[model samples]
Target: MKRLALSALVALGLLAAAPAAWAHTELIGSDPANGASLPQPPTRLTLTFSEPVPAESATVTVTAPDGTAWTVGEVSASGATLAVPVTPGASPAGQYVVSWQVESLDGDFVSGKTTFTLAGAPPAPPAVTTSAAPATSAPPAATSSSVTPTGTAGPVATTSSTAGAVPAEEGGFPVWGWVVGALVVVAAGVALALRLRGRSG
Candidate 1:
């Protein structure tokens, strides 16, 4: 009778422990599978859990090798799957890390991390070219009106004659005054000869 009672107690204890073990959530699998190497980055990350997780209580973060966050938008929970979007072009060629936390069916929190490496180098950035502006020519200087042309003749200057000045010879005497002196000498000789003839008669 004691053996029968001990067996019943042992069965009840095992049953209670089984439910506690099954109620705990665990990360069973991932889309990029842990320790995976790929030629390119993925657009989204998916995590499979042993039990359904509440979307509001779940958080997933993806970090690049340079320690930059790559995850975007809200974490979505559908049945036993949790998914979050990631930027495809943001990460370079290197190892990436995914860290996640979720509330289990038993109201306990579970957190874990996984890592993956990218296979090749990231695509080279597009070449940048800058065009220089066209050179502008300065305007020509203005020409002055006071300047004379190279092959042209300048103006001639003239002086006006005086009103009452007489025209003189090279000796500084007038030609008309010399002629009148000669006429006066001839008249005096004629008058003296006429007086001598009257005295002889």
Candidate 2:
């Protein structure tokens, strides 16, 4: 009977200590530290836990002062530490909130939030754009061309200067005067031949 009682006490002791060994995972510290005011924000965000946790059921969000999310993608968890990416241009000035939730190693879902301050983002340089005034090309120099004519001409009739003048005739006998002069010469020759024959007789 005493041997059974001793075994029962041993079992009881082990059952009591089991809860402490399987404790839930929890956030212990962070890279930015709790409520730290940063002059220059960190390149990567980090979260430390009391025990190892899986990344599948984990979620972390870093919110800026203007309520915009600064985390880029899914967070990575290895061992008891979780690492999150800080988006390149997401960080801004003023107060920021770092909210988180993760499944503990014991399968417990835990969630919490913390805040920090940023000094303000650097001012961006002004953009300067200048157009080239549409490239004044002098409007092609206003070309001028001269063209000469070619080909042959048609026939043209020409007349003498005296064609329109009237023919001048004495006593109005232009054609008949030549015929009368020939007949007078013939009659005088006949009369002289008869006078010569009479003198010889």
Candidate 3:
């Protein structure tokens, strides 16, 4: 009985010294730190744990606010760090959830969640209606189509002003009246000359 009790005590001491054998892996740190706000989405993710996890047994998923998966490539583990390449989805511009489940070296599984947000651009303001009037308003009449061009026809008032531009000759000052006055002056001079010639002879 004394020998069995001693063996039991030694086993208990071994269990106590190796506490990690019974415990699952725990998260130690991560890139794009938990609860952090980033200006944009990260290209890859790094998750560190207290225990080394198997790369084949590790699973990592990233989700956008719309619940779309953005994880890409295979999950890989190197030492105590698990690395995953993320395919940054379109508009990764809101709250994001990162979930992980990995198997520790001791065959125990541990799971956890982390949250981060990207500075999202504000929703575009509703498009403005540039038109000042409603669509149902009636269009104006097309009077321009009915009007015809008269190239030579002008206003009578303007024509009359153009015709009176030059001075008019009166009937009392005709060219025939000036000709008859010249003939009368020549006849009186001829008769006076004739009378002088007759006296000389």
TM-score-better candidate, 1 vs 3: 3
- Top-lDDT candidate index: 1
Model 3, 82-118: lDDT tens per residue? 9999988775678899999998777777899988889
Per-residue lDDT tens digits for candidate 2, residues 65-139, read 877777557789888899988774566678888898999866779888877888866689899988777866666
Q: Rank the candidates by TM-score, best first.
A: 3, 2, 1
TM-score of each: 0.53, 0.53, 0.57
Per-model C-alpha lDDT, please? 0.86, 0.80, 0.83
Cα error, candidate 2, residue 63 (Å)? 1.0
Off by over 4 Å in 2: 88-90, 121-201
**Model 1: residue 84 alpha-carbon error in angstroms:** 1.0
lDDT value for model 2: 0.80
Summing lDDT over every window of 10 consecutive residues in candidate 1, give the lowest-scoring window.
Answer: 143-152
Worst 10 residues of 2 by lDDT: 146-155
Taking all chains together, the TM-score of candidate 3 against the true structure is: 0.57
How would you encode candidate 1's per-residue C-alpha lDDT over 1-201 as one tens digit per residue?
Answer: 999999999999999999777677999999999999988898889999988999899988888888888746688989999988887547678899999999998788999999899887757999999999999988988954454557759634445689997757786667887889989989988999999989999
Q: Name the regions of candidate 3 deviating beyond 4 angstroms.
A: 1-16, 20-23, 65-68, 88-94, 125-169, 173-201
